[model samples]
Target: MTQAQNPFNVVFVLFDNVTQLNFTGPAQFLCRMPGAKVHVAAASLDPVMTDVGFGIMPTVTFEDCPQSDLLCVPGGLGVAPALSDIQLIDFVGQQASDAQWITSVCTGAFILGQAGLLQGRRATTHWGFTSLLPMVGAVHEDARTVFDGNIVTAGGVTSGIDFALTIVAHLHGEDVARSLQLNFEYDPAPPFAGGTPATSPQHIVQAMQSRFYDDRAAEMEKALRG
Candidate 1:
């Protein structure tokens, strides 16, 4: 195929404790994009531990990875420490310098923000941490997926799927995106209509915030401040 026929050089930046789904969900779809070449990159070739008690092996090290056409960062409990990781942050900043699309899934947006990519951009992340986007100079958008120029940010976890499809549609066309949706049986029928804060019961939302995100967000804020 000619260069125009096969052009995407997609790269996913992996780190220890990353929420596996945040990367895997989007990878599942994006790997199928026409002419797409996906690269899983990290500091080394070691298996990166994930939040779900497993490890994802990296295909390339930061120094060896090719310049990305689409660069993605996925978030997890590891993000706080990752914020302080100078080498990792530098790698992200360097790849993004020439990437056609810059993106993050869930709290990974903060990583992008740390690299100075989200400044002045309209973005979004997991609803619980949307308020922290401002710390990175990002104007938070109230949506599952927010697109500003070539930067795309997705809400928590599964929202990466939507983000990927949106990118597919943008690059190829809605018809191609629709076909991939069908191929993957992308229809979502949840047992409950309560994914987001708005749709979820107020009590559950409060309890979750109290039990988890409240503290997590506090830590994220401190990390950003540093």
Candidate 2:
């Protein structure tokens, strides 16, 4: 298809146990871009649940997904299972081979790594899992949004909003992004000053680590090796 005639396709990889906001946040902005057509694709047509109480149904199946201009993966507790799905990994690898951009929010970067897409790429993930990047050949960078060529990885859940705005600014221009931000009223005046490990109390960080990510590194290593 001619460049002008071709639609800008943005495909989101949807699976069970995802953090819904990680997918929904970016998608809200991405779909607003000019000529952008958004899709949620999964291994099958079944409904998928989020780590939270809700569920979503995939609009497309991997077997029939169109080649996407941008491919996005979302992360949550579900990523561990996604990492073990060889079909999903191969599909991600195939899509990444030709996609203009491969992006992820939160632990979604791990999915990209499992797809063999992060080799030597500078990437980032949720703060707690950033260390796991090196195991999959990615150079870990601590930032809200990281761009290493065609790969853009966002840190944590809320960062997905920032990641989307960044992508839109780069692809569609700052004016478009700014206008969209205004439309969304994207100003943030967070109530607490302890969003990051550096800002949060050591005890709080430790408690979080102990609760959510104590064994994640080892688990990821095993998943990657398998």
Candidate 2 lDDT by residue in tens digits, 1-226: 6466678999999888899999999999999998899989998898889989788898999999999999999998888878989888888999999999999999999999988889999999998888789888999988999999999999999999999999999988999999999999999999999999999999999998998687876676677777
Put down candidate 1 lDDT per residue, 103-180, tens digits, no spaces.
999999999999999989999999999999999999989999999999999999999999999999999999999999
Task: Report, for every candidate in turn, its global Cα lDDT versus the true structure.
Answer: 0.96, 0.92
TM agreement with the true structure for every prediction: 0.97, 0.95
Q: Model 1 reaches what TM-score against the true structure?
A: 0.97
Name the runs in model 1 displaced over 4 angstroms: 1-7
Q: Which candidate should be chosen as best, given lDDT against the real structure? A: 1
